[model samples]
Target: MVERSHKPGPISATTASSLPQAQVNVSDDNSKVTATIPSGDTVEVLLYGATIISWKSNGTENFWVSDAAKLDGSKPVRGGVPVVFPVFGPPPKNHATSSLPQHGFARNSRWEYLGKSTSESASDDSVKMDFGLYSAGLSEEAKKAWPYDFGLVYSVTLTKGELSTILTVRNEGKEGFDFNVLLHTYLRIKDISTTTISGLLGTSYVDKVLDARESTESNSDLRITGETDRVYKSLAQDTTTVVENGSPRFDVVRKNFRDTVIWNPWTEKAKGMGDFEPKTGWREMLCVEVGSVAEWVRVEEGESWEAGQTIKSLV
Candidate 1:
């Protein structure tokens, strides 16, 4: 059985020497970093994909990871927030990203932790950490697949009340590169049947599961009952909320992210995937991804682009 945990706080504690002042800890194996605040909230990120494996707030885990997720750097981490870059899904023939694999190489490539910036005060207790991935650091195999010198700086900030993820892409070579980025975030909830999405009324979307056709939404709040794979484009607003029962549980606030993807594998699709353990796990997790996926963002030589989203746990 694939069991899920609604565990409170982090299972791993921060290192002893770094706690009193910064409340941040790096794993002994140098594989992951965990940051905690005095309020007992914590977040853990693996350097493998710079994937956020766990994030806890309001004394509950806000992100979901599969019970059988691979953590040995074998493949892309099964859940949490996985960074999709250069390509979103399959690559089109003859396109710049055609030479790359699905979802590009960012999630599978190793990243470097560039350290954290201090910002603790009597009124504010937000911690920010940055990770970097550059063309020069990629493996030769990855370089041969899609050769373009670029730099990616990903920042994760844990505020007293919410969590924010920001990304910056810089062209480091004389040649330009076209890319797409998506923060594939999986949110944990009590029940999919009772959960509803708000703030996407009248927005047009492409139904990936339904012949990839376009249609407009008519509801201000929508519920998911079965398999759903939709790419909501040109969102009417920047904020999307997950409502459970009659109360709001989480608010997804985005910045410069032109698209929102609401997806759930549901029953049948969930069982077909090798990584989605505890097949029934789909009942408790929903993917609300944000990115610039409707069209590719072309970075000119010596130029850069930026975008991000902030998820607030209202519960």
Candidate 2:
């Protein structure tokens, strides 16, 4: 709900209401809902999270209740909404991104606001915000190191309380490029020990926890009670990572990809996180990343590719 103007001045009051007819406002705080339908029942989105932070109507519900704040510092925040791109996971010691970075460069970079718009949805009110990041704008020195003429655009929209993200990757130049990409999302949960993730059980995965310390072949379903890290490969479209407690279930549906990185660094590992809060934070969140770690996405000259994820609340 924060001001999303690309200009460097005060936010325009008419920005949200000025959108298309399908858009309206159902929010008191400008930092909450951006666009809405005429009925004011459904909201378009919350740009700060590009992240449909929360949505509720007609007895159904959706909300980012966990204190998963946004990542807005040079140092990563202990817990929050962090964007990941360009590369995923730890880079080689001599790699270009080996400079104290985690889950790639997007979260570490600033995204430019393109504009705003509205749409009609079954949920009634749908709003869309476009955000982009590019390699062309980087410094000459930076280009020399990670040479890839790339442009990543994320179109985040909210309708009927569901947050849908459409990611587009373009090879902005006359060259091919490859990189591991992921949306390193940490969704807040009630408790780590009490929460049980379904759908992934019995599925095969490459254990990163053991891989980080030694080399081995891991092909197993991920059910973690403590420290865990793994990338599940060759997953089916219906495949889902469901975090459940009692009756309701929150599903992280992954698509058009071949890797699912499940991570939870408990105890010592939690304390060692770059910006993680060791005191009372580790258990309230779960990192289930939608990624392309099995292989790199290759974009040809002047072409583009797309991938996305949908975070749905089914309580």
Query: How well is each residue in 1-315 modelled by candidate 1, as lDDT tens digits?
Result: 765686567678555444444478899999998998766678999998899999998689999899989998999988899999989999889997888889999999899999997565556666788999999988897899889999999999998668999999999999988998999999998999999999889999999999999999888889998999999997869999999997999999989999999999999998999989889999999999999999989999999999999999987
lDDT score, candidate 1: 0.90
Model 2 whole-model lDDT (C-alpha atoms): 0.60
Stretches of candidate 2 exceeding 4 Å from the true structure? 1-72, 93-101, 121-123, 139-141, 212-222
Q: Candidate 2 has which clashing residue pairs, if any? A: 1-31, 1-32, 2-31, 24-36, 44-127, 69-80, 205-220
Q: Which stretches of candidate 1 lie over 4 Å from their true place?
A: 1-20
- Give Cα-based local distance difference scores for all models: 0.90, 0.60
State which candidate has the highest lDDT: 1
Model 1 worst lDDT run, 10 consecutive residues: 13-22
